[model samples]
Target: MDPEGARIQDDPDVKVMMAGSTLRKVKSRSWKKQRHFRLLEDGLTIWYKSRWAGRGHSTFSVTEVEAVREGHQSEVLLSIAEEFPADLCFTLVFHGRQGNLDLVADSPEEAQAWIRGVRKLIHKAQTMDEKERLDQWVWDWFQKADKNKDGKMNFKEVKKLLKMMNVDMNEEHALHLFTMADKSESDSLEIEQFVYFYKMLTQRDEVWKVFQDYSGDGEKLMLEELENFLRIEQHEGEQSGQHAKELIDRYEPSETAVKQGAMSLDGFQMYLCSQEGSIFNPEHQNLYQDMSQPLSHYFISSSHNTYLLEDQLRGQSSLEAYIQALKRGCRCVEVDCWDGSDGEPVVYHGHTLTSKILFKDVVSTVKEYAFKTSDFPVILSLENHCGVEQQTVMAQHLSQILGDTLLTTLLDGQVPQQLPSPQELKGKILLKAKKIGGLEQCLDETLTDEVSDDEEMADGDPESPCTEDPPAANKKHKKSKLSRELSDLVVYCKSVHFHGFEHARSHAKCYEMSSFSESKAKKLAKEAGTDFVQYNTRQMSRIYPSGLRTDSSNYNPQDMWNVGCQIVALNFQTAGLEMDLNDGLFRQNGCCGFVLKPEFMRDATSQFSPEKPEGHQGYKPLRLSIQVISGQQLPKVNQKEGSIVDPLVRVEIYGVPQDQAKEETSHINNNGFNPVWNETLNFVIHAPGLALVRFLVEDYDKASRNDFIGQFTLPFTCIQAGYRHIHLLSKDGTIIPPSSLFVNISISELTSGS
Candidate 1:
């Protein structure tokens, strides 16, 4: 016998039925037919083919095994059992070289000895046939114990077997049994545990279900479900190429092409065709390939200007107009609330509301509209024109209704010191202060004043005071101040939330020129946990000359450019001279142009080539028509003196269209000029769509040149566009030099439909 066969002899519970062919007759005719039946040492047997031929021979041995309790087949059960020693009482499979041997053990030493015996048998086995036979012995035992054909033996079966032997078993006890018997941790049991655990727990119905659930369909559960799902779907999508193309076409329109004057869909399509390497080009297979990754930059709102709700709703009934404006991309909404006579906060810009729009109605409308769309993320800034008492109540009510989604300004009761915790609302809250006391100091002062007034009531009888006693008039005044401060704070917080701290500004000065102190403002922002530094853009521009001077003067254009760049966000009064500069002749000159020429007869000449030359790079001087203006003086000599005359004196250039001729005519009208006769006049001819024109003044003496003054460069592109009125004002509202001279210009591209 093999060493494994030897170990089986040591296992006391292991029974090897070795009744010969004659003794097997009482069992069945088929059982009796087995002539050469060799009972292996591991409680399994093999019968020679002749004896097994007429009999119904199972591939596995017909013996009761302990470990095959949980619905596992005999073959599988024995295969699992052969891995460990027979002493440990657990129904788990053991992966071993000689298949799974049944563990038959009642003690750790006995199980160890059985395991040693099996190992010795495997080591000594010389021929492959002998080794296979030994393996078959183990497999046969597994087949006998496996009650209902499942492939695994679980803890329940092991516990039941312990219970049958009057030995209690818990999870720990079962794990102990498993660890001892399952030498390889492959969830298999050896002979002793297999036989004992199986007989205790095996039931026909339960075993059958276990077998069906685990290996009935003969398919194993895969480990890479998520990866497989994604890969399969992606493959399918790639296979349907047109579908993928359609998806890209529906979204991700080309922003660059759109910015470059591609207005209509057809225009965009044409541009794509013309610019073969552009994003919209379908032939470029790599187009949108990187779109799966995130974009490097995105556009965010810097700041927003809003009209007060009361102002807008003054003549209207509902908020439809305001809602429409919001749809047009207004980021901020302003609502001015005043305390009513009854102390209710009401929305109105003026002292009285002529319309029926109420505060509650507006709130309801805002909430309704907010629910309708997820795209519009609007922040509401409530300008509390109402008294302190009313504003606090209104703010609290609004907070309750809107929850944290709506960004609100700080209210009287919402001071950081007063809050139970730092204000952690859903939306941001900005603390607003016009002066240098800081938000905390302001709130403290307001609270102190309240306490001081209440001192009078200290001596009064506690019960005598009415439940709703009217507040003192002086107290009311103090409360009103607090309310206004709270309202301002709330507005500031709302601004910060929507446009970030950088865009928020103090409105305390009411559009005054001197409200902003950059350093002080920045300090205040730090205290408020914000980084916003607000300034009046127009005031800053006017007071601090942008340092761009054309004449021989101390100036710095680069510094001016730096200042402009620093002002990433600015508030502009759209109706002012700055607006005019953006829209008028200054635009025609160039977006960066600030100065106007002095001469009535303006000439524009480019010393450089009209088109950029290949590799020919250098600075180009822009030459203009120069004239000497004499204030109310006539030149002493004309062409008779033979001196150089004022080039612009007697020029009579005509045939230009009415729009093109207006800039020169306007200049002449402002200067009150008509040249003398008999003088070979030179006029800086400024015509539409022309590149450059020069004028040489003749007949007029050199001394007379001083009398005719001022020089200007008329932008030909502007003249062509029919904008005849020159902008006399600069961005800071300063008048350009020789304000009498006018030159029309327009250069920025206009939207196709607009």
Candidate 2:
């Protein structure tokens, strides 16, 4: 290795070079070219040369190497579909478009060494990227804090900076940050050291950091102070004053309380990030519940018009949509298939100007990403606009791309008394299209008798351009038959027509599924709410956005989910309040896209409604008292020169609310660096378990709509119910380090409840 390249070579993880490794021409899958590879600071670099082959060197961005693993030599060679003969050598595999670089090592130990070294490099690169991103964020905040642009921010300037970032800083917390950033122990911080201050504030990321700031010592937490921090600082005077001591004892038992006062930062953080916070509760019982029940037993994450990136008409439909949906834990996705000009079936929003892609491409993409984010079964909600010939092609493509993963029969070959659980269908794909054989022919007797395999066809999705009502009895309408090739793929998820609660009970069988338009489902809820819940108990029901959602906006997923609709489908491409609520609800339970239904809704014999149940009284109205204390490193919207933003912190509560649901602080100007509102806002919540709190940071502008900086929304159950720092995040949901609001939150049962 050259002196300049020696740094990577000298890495403790790096070792003796191996022999017989070469780069494969991806399209050709050839190994004729011998190559040498090394890890550079930013990426993986490779060199190849041969007598007949052109010598070249190239580098792939570290992020481009999506996956790396040790591989079997002969098996790997055969699997890559290359023409290489079986060889008993060690191999390493890197999977991605950056080129599937397969390297042969001299020994198994060498292969392991390479795998370890590459993984370490990948991790280091990713960390560095994140740190760089944070540095840029800090610089932006720094520039905004120094309004005068004198290269440094004074104590007053730093204080204002904290307010802007939604951080409430006392003299002590502020000074610790300020003096540390000023290595000179000076009274100010240079712009260059702003990121250093940010690291100090966020690196520990322990609740104790903030707790200590509010305590007498910069380390020890006092009982009285903890109580006040909970009651006064958190605006939660109603909470038990001894709450801190209890949490400390439960989570950080290693540390005994002080003689008089008790608590520590470690204990508090453990509680905050625990299931108690409603954040990452992997141990929650709901997540580990029996996954062996039928698919309908879960509130599955679903998407409508998943192919369209924007508008249904004139919008571009791409495979990316399927990948995006699958990665987000969407267990079910819609595809409208029409005959393409190339004799293949194409997917798009039919009868519209939406662009199209080969149905095969969608299938391939699904196969790749279906289990990437979650291992739950994926349901393909097929909307057919194609004829029999291409429909067969579509089925063939699915069968080919998905192979054994596509479910073609009941797992146990027995008539299911109930639907199988997601756990049972792991790595499997189910089709939610209509069956035309014994089921779709309206031969009710066939369903009553021993069921035979049926030929299935595509169902008319509500938003499908070709969707139409069943032909009237008076009208002589010819029926279309599904080819057996495509029909065989519709195993357990056979889509069935539902006439109503009564019709479903009388005609629909257990395995057949139903789809309902929003209006129809809402009508059912209003008239036969209990009956609908009963119907959903044994069979699957899908609710899609009505045709009226032309702009691709979303309906309230909660409304349908409340009724136990398993597949409450939405336009996954759109983002809004409805989408936010959907994300929040499904974010739990491993984000597997299949959340178990509530006990009341899941009980087959119980009659339920979203509103007050028959024997139960309505919920008690609750009051939330939230104090907007101060912000630290509040992000500014893109502001022009000569202008500093006025930031406002809004506390918006979403749920079944009886009155106006939001309150906010008056704008604090020029203090984006450290905004201090010290304002208390209150709200009366009607739905406690169904409630969510969203904290938004905005740049206030008089002449224009308030520009959004960022926000974070989490279920009310996640709130720590004490005085804790509320970390702020970017609009896209990435955390903005050192940026958070210091606030007190108090929840009380309303006395006005009748």
Candidate 3:
């Protein structure tokens, strides 16, 4: 049955944009058929139906969408509409997807409508407040199920709510939820209890599944199985097994303590959330070593266009954008500060219709949210467009809102030769902007009430028209000046326009930072690999995407990181494979947004190209053998009655070499809960230092694309070597323990000259 057609009558969360006469084209095949495409209302997904007999229903998430439209070909496509062209199409590229979606349109109007609607909807979905959206969703479910206008829901009403959400909840599970939600045992649920019930329901399901998977006799797991679980899943060898035993013994003080092998579900939730919720193992402190190096010695998590909540041209610039980025452990955020209608300056995208937010509001939001997740210093990269007087207001707002947290003096108060470490500037906010002049000179020139007063600022609305004074009679506009208030705040992180690498080297001051366009950085990386790596060790370097790539897309961060760049800024609003790689790399050392540069890159003496470098030692190939034991208890995707999901375990090895990377896996079957593949896989690794292993559980579908069940990635060096229980994790990075893959891994180096 078509989910789109099945739910269209309900007019639920998903809205239909165009469903009657649109075409759908799958990427992997050459066939193009007439189909009905449904652009969803919430912008999270799009559903498609083939008008032809053989095709069925399919859905694609917006996060998977990489690009839309093709070279403004709508006009050309429309002009040739009368020709009845079979090849008339638009390409939709997706991340990691096998093929590009070649969407065909019968008419030019249909093509234009589909393209515009999808792009616009995607923008709105990305920009909305996540928590508020969830609240709205819960409220909508409550309103739909309460048929008799009662303030609360009965057991039947609760089941109806599940049906409305398209959740496949069995009767026993439904009863379990009602009992948990009905704390007073009244058999009724109010709105508050409904939300809490939903939250606890998922947690209970996860914990229960894990407990059921390991408990062989439908009771607690035996000691042998518990030890195997700790060795494999937790990646802890003998030490972790002992710790697990202690934990189980402490949490579950059962009368059968010595006789029993495992604990019950009562202690399972605490273990998953507490022990498995961390990034690094306690024994592996080597990964967090060398924090004493200057802050520039680390790769920082950064964001570009931090103010725009959606599209670069028309999205609303909000304080919420700052909050979202900071909460996600971003250390550097961009602010485009321009003159506002009022005396204060505003932050927004200049030369565009994007909405404006007050400078003070952005600062206050930053002050409140900054250091909440990580105590590292934040770099407020200000793209200044404000005049002298307005600039002062912006500076004053930063100082007042941030208070002593605003860094106005150098850490050492001297002409420092080395950059300050993250430890030195804890809780400090550094303003990064173009330096106008010396602080003393700027101090004497300030206090100007109105330097021409901007000839009247534009209205704050995004739709407002621009009005400007005539150019200074062709005598060339005088150079804009920065007062002491603003310039002094930029003592460190003074942004400098990059001309060339050699010119950047002339200034040895670590405080003077250089910004590079993505193209320039890539070009320099390719051209001067050795020289660029050396420069990054001493001075701070920042790389941002090229302006021409204006959809807020990202460059391959690995390209810049290979050259030791500290801040390779990415668009936080967009999600794709680039974001995945970024998350995987930083999922080490406690996720503090500072990853210590690799040894070769940091050494300044030994030049290392991230690729194969000549004259490097310890350069040996690795032989890794992995055994796929069995999946304990894998959960079904979407919780449907009959899942078409044939589960398979894919072991992927990602190295620097483009071709050397490989993925091997066991056979696909539906018995994931108790799958016993006993499959042994082996690989020859070319770059262990620059490699990471990703374990993925995917559902194989013969008719369409495979669905992702869950996955976890870690550096090749950090993994504990042994027969360990590999714990699985959801796409959101939360641990789902006891639902594990038991595997034995043997990593050894092949002798050279063999």
Candidate 4:
């Protein structure tokens, strides 16, 4: 059981939840109906059903609930605000892309009771240790198997449960284990008996073999033996003894084992699955990177068409999207502003069927969540399609809603030679839009003639009209007039046209930046990789996805980061390999939404090209060897009964042209648990600093494409050399604990092939 859950039953909120209530489920203005919701006896699951919908009920685990928002935070709740009081409303936000559940209670007290109770349960679920989580998993399975609610599962039910769990066990062996666990002489097994039977059925023989290799006795590991294993396998040099003792104290379930300074097999498995055994270095988990560098020297996390929750064409525009992006530590968010009939500027994809949100609400949402995840500056990339009158409303909304958080004036009372550091401008919102003139002109006059920035509307953003137009056709696309009220708010990030490398090198101001479509940026990176790298050293550049991606898909952000592009914006709503790479690159630096570029990429005079990295000066290749040892509790790609997965591991390297490679292990037949492949894949990385390593597992098939199981990606620099476990994540980046790949990693300077 979880230590946090021990006290939860005594919580006042949980008591109130057990009593239950009839709450109004709010889906839209017209769809407000009463639903009876109550906490189950287990205290970890919530049961709900509509009074009218007979024989139809549903249950969601507390672990699946990510957060509970109070009052009108959700779009559904806001739609029926007049029908329900703010104090009586709340929303339950789930993990991944699951839609939120908005509800309204009869009283404020009842609303607070459900909100606080669910939050308590979520906290307990999140803080569970590896052993506790395993226990919970077993309990959940038992609940499913015991369909008759008799508190027991018979042999027939157990057989069905095994198939549901992706296991194809021999019937005779399963029967022998089940008979051993059924000590009460009854054919059916109780909850405790079921747990014992599961332990016998899923015994990790692979881990036992490893434990036997390290232990003198086949049962437990002594202090000296555990210390030796840590030094040799975990590379824990001087602190091996101390770390071993700490592990024994933390993981050893038996008090006798702790007193004897020994670790049982259970304790050893717990330690190996803990955060300390993760492939990522724990030291890099905190704010370990230098953050005082100029803003141009860092790669900023950005999102394109951030207001849309789905495809660019018919997506719903919601403030929740902005809140979600900011919570993920995205430093830049795009808002497409158009003239609304209500005299307020609206944000949505222009000339499309996407819904609209008030610009003021978006600014308000940004102000609330900008610094919640990181104390870094946020860049508001405004795609302005509104005229002067509505533009003033936008400026007023920004200034009023954001208040002191808005960067309306130049920092240090002067234009900077280079952009200010994130640390210097912490908690401020910077506007990245068209400015009529330089900083001097903005401070000097009330209005100036609008400058024609060709690249301004050519970003290929979902809202830009000429995004997909040909160059000849782009000439006929009229530019919107810039309002002095809006233009004056742009301080450091002034949108300007990109003439040429030579022109930018000579005439481009430090405060001026340009936006490029993915195609144009890729062309520049390939043709003049060195010049692009040099140019980015002084001025920032933003690369957005092509407008042709009507589905709001993303390009490989690594292509832009190779050229030192500061803000490589992608559709945050989409989840795939592209977003995985983006999440991997920014996972370090405390996830503060900024990572400094490599030393060569930061130096203006240094020559480095992503296309020809081998030719760079002082290039030294390093050899990386990864031993794909085994897998643990791999998930089934198919949920059908009796469907076991044939799992395989693929290791991919993403970097410069010469460093990109992929290697895979042979698939094991009909196994999703404890499949071993002691194959070592090797690679030579010329630019290790820019490399990202991805470990992907799939259900291999000969007749069709393999099904994705899970994957984990991280920067090569963050890789720790040792025997580590790669905890896999689902497609949406939520961790699926216990689903991991065990690997031994080694890195050394490249020598002659041997």
Best by lDDT: 4
Tens-digit lDDT track of model 4 for 1-754: 4345557887999988887789988888888889999987677889999998979998988877878999888878888888788999999987766678899999999999999899988888887888888888888778877888899888999998887776767899889999999999799899889989988876777677778989998989999999998998777899999999999999999999999999999888788778888899888878887788889999999999999889988889889888878878899999988889989999888778888899998998899889999999999998887779999999999988898999988778987888888888999999999888788665577554465646545333533443343456446455547788888799999888789899998988888888888998999999999999999999999998887888889999988998899999999899999989988998888999999898889888969999888777867789999999889888888887778999999999998878889999999988786788989999999898899999999999999999999999999999988778899999988787668998889888987774
lDDT (C-alpha, whole model) for all candidates: 0.30, 0.65, 0.65, 0.86
lDDT computed for candidate 4: 0.86
Cα shift from native, residue 722, model 4 (Å): 2.1
Query: Residue 159 lDDT in model 2?
Result: 75
Q: Which is the better candidate, 1 or 2, if ranked by TM-score?
A: 2
Among all windows of ten consecutive residues in candidate 3, which has the lowest summed lDDT? 455-464
Tell me the TM-score of each prediction against the true structure: 0.25, 0.69, 0.62, 0.95
* Residue 722 lDDT (model 4): 78
**Top-scoring candidate (TM-score):** 4
* Residue-wise C-alpha lDDT for candidate 2, range 302-404, written one tens digit per residue: 9998987787667878776776678678889998888899899998776677877889878887888899988889999898767788988988898889899
Q: Per-residue CA lDDT of candidate 3, range 708-744, in tens?
A: 7777777676665544556677654544433567665
Ranking by TM-score: 4, 2, 3, 1
- Give the per-residue lDDT digits (tens) of candidate 1, residues 455-497: 2222111221111134464343342244333333343221111
lDDT measured at residue 288 in model 3 versus the true structure, 0 to 100: 69
lDDT of 1: 0.30
Model 4 CA RMSD to the hidden true structure, in angstroms: 2.5
lDDT of 2: 0.65
| Clashes per candidate (backbone, < 3 Å) | 56, 38, 8, 0
Query: How well does candidate 1 match the true structure in TM-score terms?
Result: 0.25
